[model samples]
Target: MAGPTILSSPSPPSEEAGTILLETERLIIRRYFLSDAPAMAETGNDTLVTANLRAGFPSPYRLSDAEAFLSTACKPDGTAYPQHNGIFVKPLTADNPSPEPRFIGAVGIIPKGDVYFRTWELGYWLGSASWGKGYATEAIGPFVRWCFDTWPGLNRIEGEAYGSNEASQKVMKKCGFIEEGTRRGAAEKLGVLKDVVNFGLLRSDLEGVKELVRDS
Candidate 1:
């Protein structure tokens, strides 16, 4: 809980062009920084942390894994999602009024194709210690609104979680996402098949949730 500034991405200016720095009442959703690797490794290495996540996230998440992620995910290049951002706590410093917050999670939406071209898939994960505190709901409510408000081409956003991960569904619901049903046995995590519970949020839904940012 110490930071006078948001950790800036190490990528070159050209590669960091569209990188966003988002702030909420209690969170700072910004670009991943190289210095955050150690913390990322610590959190990413925990099995409980990645339990509900896909296999794409390394199990024994190492410093190298963190390094690689920062390199690619934080780059300004088009490889990463146009709006991928990090989540940090807004901690107060005794000496400084605004210290750089601690990195606690990651969140973003990736656009899709075909008839879904105007839609984006939302994804997010918080470290073990940061859960059950309404951080995800608060961050998501504003993030979803930002996407719809900032980008006119986007009409809808998609989200999915394992049936076992009820917390994720709740966050989605609180943030205005509708339960669209589930894909049975769509994912296998920890040797057990899990259903993928799908959710979607429309630009229209953002209206009712605009107060989320206001309340914050």
Candidate 2:
């Protein structure tokens, strides 16, 4: 595989303000915490999880690597900061008012400033063990809803999945994103060029989706 891109921008400053944690019937989407480093390392270090991602994410991810990621993700005013929500399964709730959340995966909104700051790209990854459980679909829908409600200036949310990643494409479709087109050799994964299928969901599209979900 090709070497990872080195980030040119300075890292964001740390902040104590916590991000909003959203709960679905089966998952809890929340901000990263210091205590989650070990779990993050365990999940992210898996080769299956990192293979689809950009080259920078190291294999055999260490605790220190997880700490650095948490710092970057929690930065106060950074564009690439805490916008990534860690996905977790909802534990038994009968004994508690709320379910105990366990880390499983992550989803994020990556803003493209050149696109008028009104467009954000969506990215997600789940643990190999967590695959095929519809968690991606369940988590992504609410995250998009929360994004639109939280960021009024957002006009569009876009995503691109490798052609071979049918499951990811399905998740985007289920979350109301429409296929825009395809880009051949858009990315290189594991030393080979990969085709990518683009998907997008506009603000108006989200409105229709919201209505349908409400009626159901």
Candidate 3:
């Protein structure tokens, strides 16, 4: 008899502790929670946002999907196996605080094993309302650096941006990811054949980048 088809497991969190909130000068990248589900669903369900992404995200996203995602990404032990983080803008002042942190987007690093075990696949998305602010660039750079710093064995990180996604390609470029090449018809989105541009950053390339300092 054939064995059951099982989903692959994510890599364990490294011995070096992971942070709940990674602060850059302008943004905070943190873990997703059930509380953020409504915002997440709203951001993801936008036609403008979903147009560039894979087909799995339904047009009218449900709260149940968000809950499932939060549970999967954040386990009960408080350790995120696959390492998904939410992007939020920092408030301008210490005294005057925003009621809720604006949900700019989410990013993740998926580790693969093979000849490519040392490589992780990177993916991200930004809400339509958050466009044009350079938040994507700011948030991704530190996240990439943190990933390499935490996992010494990781040599390369790669991502694919659909040809039409100039904003995402710009983020990749700003974060020091070099354009490797293009894969023809690598994905199908919204009934259209999309060409994806491949980008990668090596550990050596990230060596000169400064490590992010934790905020109190």
Candidate 4:
């Protein structure tokens, strides 16, 4: 059960290549880089990881898949797509010190338009090896706050999990997302129909929430 000493950052760090969006005790959530394709492919190529994620994530994820995703997340000149990020394992210890940030997962929001312009959808996925460490729970809170702070017009953020994904549901609960309802048989994954459970957090829900660190 190794961990980092600093559990929260009032101000997140920044770098030229990737802007550090948020930091927690053991994770660094930042914009993805094209070079991350290899690591992304390696870590995301698990059936379990893809099973819990959206249909877009391919099983046996290859370098090509990772490349396409990176291409979509950022432009050739390195400008980020604005909301996607890679979740890296922060190396805060000297023994395991490595200059490179270890890519472990990702988190992002899909902007809604038209009548739902003020709303957004939240999604995240971690490598199977990184599961059960509370990293998802730790990262989501501040990320949500950052979203509210970054977009003043943003009123609500929505998260949906397959009914079978209890772990994801728990993470949403821990992050102050209120369970809205279940959309029965709304999604089909791997040829099986699954209920989608909806959860939401409004800007008003952030009244007492704190500890969001954004780069200047």
If scored against the real structure, what TM-score would every candidate get? 0.84, 0.82, 0.81, 0.84
lDDT of each: 0.75, 0.74, 0.73, 0.77
lDDT per residue (tens digit) for residues 1-216 in model 2 = 543222222433233534445677777777777677888888888988887777777776788988888876765553433366688887775322445667788888777665346777898889898888777888888887766665666778899888888888988888889999999999898889999999999888986688433221
Runs in model 1 with CA error above 4 Å?
1-20, 78-83, 93-98, 213-216
Worst 10 residues of 2 by lDDT: 4-13
**Which pairs of residues collide in candidate 3?**
none
| Candidate 1 lDDT tens digits, 31-73 | 6667778878887787887898889899999999988887777
Model 3 poorest 10 in a row by lDDT: 207-216
> Which of the numbered candidates is closest to the native, going by highest lDDT?
4
Better of 2 and 3 by TM-score: 2
**Residue 37 shift from truth in candidate 1, angstroms:** 1.4
Which ranges of candidate 4 are over 4 A from the true structure?
Answer: 1-17, 76-81, 94-96, 208-216
TM-score for candidate 2, please give it: 0.82
Candidate 4 achieves a global lDDT of: 0.77
lDDT of 2: 0.74
Residue 44's lDDT in candidate 3: 79
lDDT of 4 by residue, 113-201 (tens): 66786788999998888888777887788788877776566789999999999999988877878899999999999999999999999
Clash pairs (backbone) in predicted model 1: 3-99, 3-100, 4-99, 4-100, 15-76
In terms of TM-score, how similar is model 4 to the real structure?
0.84
Q: How do the candidates rank by lDDT, highest first?
A: 4, 1, 2, 3
Runs in model 3 deviating more than 4 A are: 1-21, 76-82, 92-97, 207-216
